[model samples]
Target: MIEIACDESGADGENLVGGNTLFFAHGSVDVSVEFAGSVISEIRERIRSPAEEYKANHLLREKHRAVLEWLLGALRGRAHVELVRKESFLVGRVVEVLGGEGAPSGEGVPEEVWGAFVRAGNRLLRVRAEVDSGVLVEEFFGSLDALRSAVAGTEAGEMLARLSGRRERAFAYRASIPTLIPVLDPLFPTIVDTAAHWSSPGTPVHLVHDRQTLLTPARVEWIRQRAEARGVTLAGLRLVQARSDPRVQLADFLAGIARKIAGDEATGVGDPVLGELLRPYLEAGALRGDGARKG
Candidate 1:
């Protein structure tokens, strides 16, 4: 079975909001251990930084620009990065949970108007008046509530009126279900995507990831099941410390740099050249900035 080494940066679990980082980036490398070790040794020789274990920050500096460029170009073919915006995810969940499956059609209002309101609802959640995640979730629900007036006398209004009662119940149920909370964690989706990417045909892939508290045995099984459902074969998942595995450390470097690049792009401050270099590896389907879609 082929093996893929993986790591992540800015991982805040499900606590995307009120978390330390603005973006999460997951990286997977399909390189051999020997290749990873050689890359690390080359960097140690080039930068000559006294740090025992090298990190992304070490190469991100202006002085190391040349090495960073060399590193990105070298791993272009084998490394892939997945980027996600936390708040935008919540806005999407708002639409999925409360917006219902099928689109609404009625004499109450035109379908076009309904579409506008849906977009508006997403915008409402994207605009954060509060920093507290709990309050942010409440505000998301409240944004739905406040829209009652905005969508009044329209088909969208009727739909919101119906979902009004379910919001509180949804919140209450989520609180009671402990397992549901972990499932919301972004790491799970990133893992599933990495597994799916490497799982070729009938050949299952054994995924080696950096040690993370969230990668419990049960969760690893869930990742396998999820991968299978998506037509990907996962042999199994194994966790190792970054120090013990050079491959995992390399994955960390890619992830760390990717996260920084994504964050810079979100805020409109970054080296344009470097951002373009990492662009090809960044997942095309992840939500962009705080609320826009990317491809």
Candidate 2:
């Protein structure tokens, strides 16, 4: 059986607005628990001692960087990691578009529009134009029709016609998950499914999430139902404070590293050492960024 401990960072108001990191581990429960304690102890010691190069404002300071590098190195192949980040403005735009409100003007384009554009071919250029111009929905659809008529005999027109049949129910339903869960929807299932796949067949899975206001009983039930439908047996699902569980603390640091990287990306900065630390998981296809999908 594989035990998974989960935590998140940047979900709270932070450097990267709307940015979040969902990190979890799948491995031997006892071993992970033990290692978590050791990692916590190491971090505490490093915090007590000062390192000259580790400035106060640095997101990935030297001591924190050292601890993360060590933790990630130790977990390299033993545990799987996944990351999902969304630009808040982009997410808000997506919510607005799908929710069918134009009252609030926004700068970013919705993910569905991009998906529709890709699937609908060049005729959808008018839709893109309308969006870029911040046109109202009615005007945008009118432009779409006009473009369709102009390209009626071409291949692009046929693709544009196909876009009309795309099912948007799934995208709309995701909006109901509430709070940060909507942002986390894409990552949760992928990580759970991946962990299930890696575990021995028929072994029961236990999931422990770091406490969050959004993770209410109803939400847990919703997750359970979704997992059941997917054929993944979740033997248990519960929320606990990180301070009460060592494994959860490990998950916190893991998520923190990913969040710092994302914060760096948003601000157009780079940390080579941090990037190097995450390289193995990225190369192994364990850590993934689901930026294009709206949660």
Candidate 3:
């Protein structure tokens, strides 16, 4: 069996609607601790930062361009990342709610249906932090009437019209679970994909993640169950302090860097060369929003 170290950036738990970051990146790496430590050491030699933890920002500086490219080249095939466009994810949840899917968890709709939902949601949604969940829900539903016009005559528009015929249903759904906004945490899918990526039918993989509050005991078990159902051996999953594990720190660097670049792309300010370097490490169904998915 193999062991993979993992970490995530831009995770706001269930606060997908209004969060601090535009993208949530879940990163996993197969490199050994010694190798990861060497990577960290190499960065220190070049950048010479005073921070105890060498994060993605250290490598993202203008003066550290060569250092960042070198690190990406060194980690080329050893790393994997799954990115979520936060606002688009919220749009998917809106579909689940309006489609009468009951709850927004795993694959709430068919592939075609999910695609339609994303297109419709993309037209109306904006990435901004809401003051509270109530405001978030209210503002989302308020935009529905106009969204119909935005995606008029399209398949996504028809789907939204049929599902959201009565806007009251959306609010009622929210009222049922006052605290939970039919949340779908992207980390679950990311972990499952990461497990399948590193492990084959016979070869299991143990995942070590940087500790996250969202990963409760029940949630960890849920991830394992999902992985097993997908025919992957998630033999074990553990949480560790990133400070103690160089492998996890390596994951941190990858996740943070990926999030930054992807965020830039979503905002229309990305560098084409850097995007090319990060393209290979992305997982499936990434950057879903507006009209299509981004690689």
Better lDDT candidate (1, 2): 1
Which residue segments of model 3 deviate by more than 4 Å? 100-142, 166-182, 284-295
Reference-based TM-score of each model: 0.78, 0.58, 0.80
> How close to the true structure is residue 81 of candidate 1, measured as C-alpha lDDT?
79
TM-score of 3: 0.80
Scanning candidate 3 in windows of ten residues, the lowest lDDT window is: 286-295
lDDT of each: 0.72, 0.48, 0.72
Residue 151 lDDT in candidate 2: 56
Q: Tens digits of per-residue lDDT for model 2 on 1-295?
A: 6677766654432222222432222222223777777766666666655543221123257545666577667667655444544433233333343443222111243545443322222222112222322233333345445554555666655644553333252233332324534432344444455445434558767777777676667666666666666677777767788788877766666666665664565455757677677655442433333332222
Cα error of candidate 2 at position 131, Å: 18
Question: Which residue pairs overlap in candidate 1's backbone?
Answer: none
Per-prediction count of colliding residue pairs? 0, 0, 0
Candidate 3 local Cα displacement, residue 146, angstroms? 2.2
lDDT of 3 by residue, 50-143 (tens): 9988889889999999998998899999998877777566666666656643222213345444444343343223233334445655555445
> Model 1 shows how many backbone clashes?
0
